[model samples]
Target: MDTAAYALLVFGALAGGFVSGLAGFGTALMALGIWLYVLPPSLAVPLVLICSVVAQTATLPSMWRSFDFTLIWPFIVGGLAGVPVGTLLIAHADPQIFKLGVGLFLLVFPTVLFFNRTPMAFRFGGKVADAGVGFAGGVLGSLAGLSGPLPILWASLRGWGKDERRGIFQIFNWTVLLAALCYQAATGLIELKVIWLALIAFPGTIIGASLGTRLYHALSDRNFGDVVLGLLFLSGVGLVWSTLGLR
Candidate 1:
């Protein structure tokens, strides 16, 4: 890679890693925005998955106390089931339409929530609903390395505490992303060049994630919620702009 591409790659890794470490999810949301400018989707998609797994794994210990298998298994089961289906559909799906739909939802939903100031903790759907959200997350994860948003939104609506929400984001995304990466490898998307680029991204991801994890420990629950919502809003903007060629 050229110097410019290398710089962008590392910058993307740093940004994405920091967000993942801080929020327990968002590596792809942050990284793909920059990486796509320099790397093709095939390479960038799996790279984000790998880096996301790395960032999540690195910070897992910090969120370990919040882990509850009973609370998370439904999502995992649903997400795993969705991955191969996503792989099959990618070839037929229209990328632009998909981006526009997700981008608009991210834009509108987060904006409304950010301003509402009402704590929304709904208990209506239960575990089945959570699994359905996980299935959607898995499909998105495979399509664009985005398995966090749906579950994140659902957890927020469920009014989980910061650590509880982060736990879902971390463990759920780790499971889904790792599964997506494996599917990509099985389908030959993990090329030698992608591996080389991942090597280049490693140190930046580690450093950024380390720093972000430190900051995460200092934030209040309210502050953490605002930060996550803000990032989601910004991610929405990035997606819409890039998809519409306004970037």
Candidate 2:
């Protein structure tokens, strides 16, 4: 085994897992810096997927049976389709542009949400909106490890029910992560080493997500939303720092 690689993988798993719990996402954005230090970016992608799958799967139970399927299915269908396109886009995009785009979104999205008394709320115009989110997710997922965040951000800003958000995010993320993992694996980006690293993260992700589920119990709807959104902002800042070679 690669001792140094293994060590970083373990630590990354722990940090990534906790963040995933406290927030609904950020597992990849938080862990990627550390993972890339030991492994290639291509390999990092699948490892992220595996760890995310573990995290989201564990959290799905609390979210299950609480979703608006009319809403869930269409949006998820979009996300499922969106992720692979995003994955493919990632391979071809210019690094500088990619960095700038993610940076802008990270900096702007949360600020807008924080300042606004009310965001756009919901823009679903029947099934079309669902397809649009999926397509957006697929496109973004193809390019960046983040696909579900935009749709999720809308959900967060609108202050949807915790169970609905969790359930919706679980399906959206799971689909994106799984699809991205497949693309990486088929392209030979994933190796046994990565799988081992993902395995190491499994326990941590599960534990953290479980804690979040429990924490959800005591929070008022507004507090829970604030907590998750706050965590996402911090995570975004961390990513920006890392991208700038500061983290």
Candidate 3:
């Protein structure tokens, strides 16, 4: 790669790492959008997965004390099942259409949350419901490298505290992205170029994640939720733009 491409890759990694560190998700949403400017989807997606896992793992030690297996296990099981299905669809499905649909949902869902201030008061079913959301997350993870939005939105609706939400986001993202990375490696979707880019990007990931985790610790639960919602909205806009060939 040229210096310009390398620079862009590093910058994208830093930005995406910071976002993931703060919000406990959104590494792909932030990095893939920027990386796609310099690399194709085939290359960019795997790089995003590598950086995401790195960022999430970096923050895990801080969140381990608050981890809730009961809430996260069902989602993991459901998401694991959905990933292969999504991977299969990638070869057969029109990705632009899928992106458009998901973008619309992301846009509308946040608006609903913004208007409905008492979102948590409305119970959104039980563990079965959580698993269903996780399945959707897995499908999106495999299809778009964007599995966090659905679960992030669900955590908001369920009225989890910042730590609780972070626990879910950190563990869930790590699990799904790690699995996706392994799948990509096994299928030979991950190339040597992607590995080189990951190496170039690692330092930025560490720096940004360190800064972002500090910021995350400082924010109130309400403020953190608002920030997450805002990022989701922006990610939706990015998806819509890409699907329309505007980016």
Candidate 4:
């Protein structure tokens, strides 16, 4: 890669890592945005996957105490089931259209929640609902390297506490992202260029994640929720812009 591409990759990694560390998600949204400016989607997507795994693993220890298998298993199972389907669609699906539809939903859903005066305690989704959300996440994960947004929105709407919500976000993302990585590897989508970029971006990932972890600790639950929503909104906007072929 050229010097400009290398710089953009490093910058993307740091920015993406910080968001992932703070919010337990968003590496692809942040990093891929920058990477796509300098590299093709083929290279950009795999690089984001590798760095996302790294960022997620880095922040896992901090969130380890919040892990709850009983609450998370359904989503995991559903997400796993959806990956192959998404991978299959990767070759045939119209990504721009798919992304545009998801982006609009994400943008609108959060806005409505933000403006609602009486935010009801909405904690009535059984495992089935959770599994459904997970399946959607899996499809998105495979199709766009974006599995966190749907689950994040679900947790937020369910009125989960910070730790509980983060447990779902961190663990769900790690599982789906790792699964996607493996699938890509098996299909030979992960090339040596992706690996080289990952190595070049590793240090930025560590630094950004460390800083974000510290920031995460300082925020109140309400503030953290707001931050997550804000990031999700930005992610939606980014998706829309990208799909329009504007950047």
Question: Which of the predicted structures, 2 or 4, would earn the higher lDDT when compared with the native?
Answer: 4
lDDT of 3 by residue, 1-247 (tens): 7899889999999999999889899888888888888898778878888999999999888778878888888788878878887777767878679778888888889878877777483366688888898888988887768889998899888888888888888888889888887886888778998888899999999788888898999999889988988998888898899889984
Residue by residue across 71-155, what tens digits does model 4's lDDT show? Answer: 7888899899988888888889876788799888879988877776465567666888999999999988877789898988888
Q: Which regions of candidate 2 are displaced past 4 Å?
A: 1-7, 157-159
Task: Score residue 115 of candidate 1 by CA lDDT.
Answer: 89
Clashing pairs in 1: none
- Give the top-scoring candidate (TM-score): 1
RMSD of each: 1.1, 2.6, 1.4, 1.4
The CA-based lDDT of model 2 is what? 0.69
Worst 10 residues of 1 by lDDT: 62-71
Backbone clash pairs in model 4 (N, Cα, C under 3 Å; residues 3+ apart or in different chains), count: 0
lDDT string, candidate 2, 98-139, tens digits: 655676676778777767756345645656766786678667
Q: How do all the candidates rank in terms of lDDT, highest first? A: 1, 4, 3, 2
- Candidate 2 lDDT for residue 96: 54
Which TM-score value belongs to model 2?
A: 0.86
Report how far off residue 66 is in candidate 3 (Å).
Answer: 2.0
lDDT of each: 0.89, 0.69, 0.85, 0.86
